[model samples]
Target: MSNSAYRWMVAVPAFVVVAAFGVYLGTTHGAPTALDRSVMDTVTGLRTPTLTSVIKDVTVIFSPVAVTIWTALLAAVLVWRDRSLVRALPVVATVAAAGIVGEAIKLAVSRPRPPAIDQLGAVEATYSYPSGHVMGTTALVAAAVSVCAASVGARVAAGCLAAATVVVCAATRLYLGAHWVTDVLAAICVGVGVALVVPVVLAAVIGRLAPHLPAWVGVPAANAGSKA
Candidate 1:
């Protein structure tokens, strides 16, 4: 299917389905379900000092600030190498969409973090229905992977790294007792939707807007960042 069709047919449906799941969680008193609690306990129970140290580093590595810094570096490199920012638009758009949508849902849900009984890691003391850490990292990986290059092999490598980052980051959050299993899951789902939808939407906007420009803007995309 074409990108636009894929977004409408697949991405939009994914977003709706995940959104419904979020609503379900929100209505459930924000309590960890039995399964969620079980998973949280298992992950935290296995933590060691070495593991704790590793988890702490992952915490920072995937933090929103770190993700933004890395994203900027990636965009800078692309613009410098290509002498165009078109390749970086999807990366920027996805990150922006993720932050805005994640925050909106978080505040609307206002679900509290995992209870004190299960808490072991440093306190976040923030809403946790959909993990900000998970969402941010997910968007970062999705955007980075999507924009890293135009070659299939390069994109595949990027996908592998993105997947690994998401897994490790998600596990770190759960292992640290910073989030319920459901919180991370929901964030992943939501992030996937945003990653898929944002670039297509942004591309369409840019495509339409490009024609009316005064020729002072950046050149038309080589691939139009077409991978998105």
Candidate 2:
């Protein structure tokens, strides 16, 4: 199959699943599902002072501020290395768009965090149908992997690393009771969708504009920075 076709195959189902799931959660009026409660129960049951402290530290590492700073640094490094703004646009755009999309869905769903009893790290005051932390990390890692993984073995390794990073971010949210199980899952879906769509769309736009632009932009073609 064509690359674009494969991307759509993966991205479309993700968006559709998240949309339906979001609607279901929205209508619940912040009530946790049986599965949500079950998972939270398990997570809360496993909590210890040491583990909680460790997870709280992990929370700080994946906080919105930290994620944004690291994402910006990554984009800057990529742009500097490639000497092409187009090369790093996908990572930056994917992460930014994921944050926006995740926030919007959170607001629309208006789901509350798990009960105070389950909250271990810090209290969050925002709607919580989707964990923005997971979304941001997921998008950042996925976009970076797409840009950097060129060989089959490299792509496989990068894919595993991206998955592990996303899982850790999601786990931090759950372990701290910052989000219900669905929230992190939905964030992953949304993040993946944004990561998948943004690069191709950006590449197409840059490809169309490449001829009109000056040579200094370093975008010579649609696939300049991206690997096939």
Give the top-scoring candidate (TM-score): 2
Candidate 1 C-alpha lDDT tens digits along 71-95:
7887788677666666677777788
Worst 10 residues of 2 by lDDT: 218-227
* lDDT of candidate 2 over 1-228, digit per residue (tens): 877767878989998998898888767787988989899999888988998888888877777789899889987887777777766777787888888888888778888878777787557778887888888888888888877777878878988998998888888899888899988888889988888888778778877788898755644221233445
- Candidate 1 lDDT (Cα, whole model)? 0.77
Cand. 1 TM to true fold? 0.90
lDDT (C-alpha) at residue 173 in model 2: 90
**Which residue pairs collide, candidate 1?**
none
Highest lDDT: which candidate? 2
Measured on C-alpha atoms, candidate 2 has an lDDT of 0.81
